[model samples]
Target: MFVHPAALCESDQIGPRTRVWAFAHVLPGAVVGADCNICDHAFVESRVRLGDRVTVKNNVALFNGLTVGDDVFLGPNAVFTNDYNPRASVKKTEDDLLPTVIRDGATIGANATIVCGVTIGENAFIGAGTVVIRDVPPGAMVVGNPARHIGWMCACGRRLDADLACACGTHHGADPTTGGIVADDA
Candidate 1:
């Protein structure tokens, strides 16, 4: 729990060994887990839940209804939207906000915009500056303004070979039924 004096962590639910850096603000009711890094100038809303060892980079904001799983990496300035049809005239309640879930080991690249109501699957890799509008399958690697699956990634963060084997000697494959990839050992 190394919270910099410049950081404002109003949450009592922060786990041990987490570091909140300068200018970061963790609002009350936000649950941050152990060994997580809340980087400089990051903002976490009340309803956001971050799991263990998650890395939230500088200038990123985890708004309400967003849940980040363990070991997730959020790149610099990554944006998340909670409202799909936001209007200045409308005052929306918490129930009106859409939810976004980033599963364990997923990596969202710098400046990516994750739209609400999507589940980024386990170990999914989102490239820099991507605008993700849909659910990303497990182990899928996507890029571009409207992110599209360009390749598959291994759980160890390497691009998978054609046979779905990694250099690290891990074997993974896509599930035909769920359309999600899974580690064979799992």
Candidate 2:
């Protein structure tokens, strides 16, 4: 891993080809996977786990209890909260914190606020400045305050048509169990 001179990477668990940029702070016990780009001014807490090929953009703060899957893209200034009810006087333990899971190939847009305990499904796309209060389904495209699901997206990052077909030649169908879109083969 290549840690910039101005960056403070206390973790020994960073994988190969990962680059920690200037002013970024990756605390000890954080597990960062290979080929990840930790942009400038990002803060990664100790308990966070980042999968391979993840892109954490500038000014992002990844707190404890966050699990980022492979190929996830965290946009600049995206916010994540770990506590549902936070109080300065109350010192809560790690177990009290709720976990947020960002599934593989998901893209969290810039300035979006993701509330704790929600699972963003695979290839989901969160629009910029959106506030996510609940779980997002796979291939879902969400926007606005409280994060309404507006449409479906392909894993290749293209919006799916009414028939859930993308120009990228991928076809998806709604999963009956979860009401989420999934590839036909999946």
The prediction achieving the highest lDDT against the true structure is 2
TM-score per candidate, in order?
A: 0.98, 0.98
Where does the lowest 10-residue lDDT sum fall in candidate 2?
A: 177-186
- Residue-wise lDDT of candidate 2 within 60-146, one digit each (tens)? 999999999999999999999999999999999999999999999999999999999999999999999999999998899999999
Residue 157 lDDT in candidate 2: 91
Name the TM-score of candidate 1. Answer: 0.98
Tell me model 2's lDDT, rounded to 2 decimals: 0.97
Which runs of model 1 end up more than 4 angstroms from their true locations? none
Query: Model 2: runs farther than 4 Å from truth?
Result: none
